[model samples]
Target: MVDQWKAPSAAEPAVGDDKSWKLLEKTLLAGVQEQRRARRWGIFFKVLTFCYLITVLVLFTPLLDMERTAVSGSGYTALIDVRGVIADKEEASADNLVTSLQAAFEDPKVKGVVLRINSPGGSPVQSGYVYDEIRRLRGLHPDTKVYAVISDLGASGAYYIASAADEIYADKASLVGSIGVTAAGFGFVGAMDKLGIQRRAYTSGEHKAFLDPFEPEKPDETKFWQGVLNVTHEQFIASVKQGRGDRLKDKEHPELFSGLVWTGQQALPLGLIDGLGNASSVARDVIGAKELVDFTVQESTFDRFSKKLGASVAQQLAMWMGFQGPTLR
Candidate 1:
């Protein structure tokens, strides 16, 4: 009977009969179904992978050009947005801003540039770079008008960049002025003492860790830093005066250099801004460039992944080591 079952014939069931045939049939069907499921899953994953790759490409590459729209008459203008902290390593870096601005001015189609600024301010050096670039672009393209449109908050470094524009416009409620410099930090020496934690750091120079929170700040060091701030503040004031020319009021208001912000309504008369308006409105009405262009660099997959991976690894290492060190700014 076992031999008959082993040497099976298609014509009829042998030895084990219909029961055995039925079991074999079920097994064959299950195998086929499993293969079909696997194939479908494979196809699905392939399609998903394809979509992911496409998205990565689009984000990294300049796949799409800024959509150009026709404005009133024939003149063209480009709207460039300046948002967030302007730092060397940040997304809104002066280098990137300058490149975009320069491109806008260079474009034959782009008649003028509308610098839409909305920033709380950042690095003085970065702001100065943008300021210099704006001046250079204006010199290169004298015909193309560069207008600054302050959105919600344009202060300190933000205003520094705006001062270079041909005309500065701000919204009624916009923070227009903060013509000052500041270097902020926290002293964790008290916390360290309370927690019984010791900070060990070695440096080559005496003033290398001048602002180190762990170490006690020297009076001379504090005085030296204050001098630096004063120098930078004077530079900021001089730049503003030079940019605004005779428009600024002669009144010696404490707010001018006290790091106090002013609204657009107050700014207009104070000569902090040229008028009260936003980027789109100013672009359409003043510059005659209704169409906007964003030249910001989108992060690549490699960049995003690397950053995320690095952060994750660091977090894991910190967790593993049981380190609870506070972040240094």
Candidate 2:
């Protein structure tokens, strides 16, 4: 080799370099293909999950309605739940209650209807609507008696609804009765003054902005608002009298309509409730229909999920903004 003294050929190094480059290129292509396959699988699983959820929702919706229709041959007591605030869009709203009542009344197998109540009350207007409907339905279906059984708390609008029943019952410790109207809101004037925030609201009418919490409360407006509440209270009193009839022991009791909540034991003497019992006892002993079937209109699964997601946030926002109106409770 020394005698020859020839340099190594350049093609030898080029051939090794080309082989290394080809190996690197093959590795990169394999990696890219693997990533593409993973991405495709991820998309497929996501679509599969979406389709599963949709199928579940579709199947669940009919089952809710089917519950109302699946009455037994043996007569059963129809149970309608009035749990929570009795306002529009609430679970125990007038519309839902009315629908449930109508369904129970329509079903021939339904021996009696029981309103299972556990609420602190809500809108007077909504309560009034339900009250009227109950009376109307009672007239339409005299044999199907409606009973209200308060579990925990049934005051204000809840009481208003219970009064409409043929008979009202509750546990001895249950809270009952709050026959009055109330409108509450936060006055932000002091807070705004401290924060140096001037609220500029333009309006056409003189009393258009009377309830504006940012402004100083006027004596005249306050008087007018009280008058409105008084009128609503009077209407509530009249309805209660109509519903309870002569069962109300003392119609002129000073604290009776002063929005005082009482225990079931105390309410019995006041004629607010007929007896002490729960939904089961009322259904079995009172109605003589031991078998129970729920007639409550339930919210769809998707709607319930969406409400759970957004309801709390929206409620907090409303409270912070001081957006309020007259509520029966």
TM-score of each: 0.73, 0.81
Candidate 1, residues 18-64, lDDT tens digits: the string is 78879999999999999999999999996886566457647754433
- Please give the lDDT score at residue 68 for candidate 2: 48
Using TM-score, give the best candidate's number.
Answer: 2
Once fitted onto the true fold, the runs of candidate 2 whose alpha carbons sit more than 4 angstroms away are 1-24, 47-71, 301-329
lDDT of 2 at 67: 59
lDDT of 2 by residue, 198-262 (tens): 99999999999988989999999999999999999999998988889899975456688889999
lDDT, each prediction: 0.78, 0.86
Clash tally, candidates in order: 0, 0
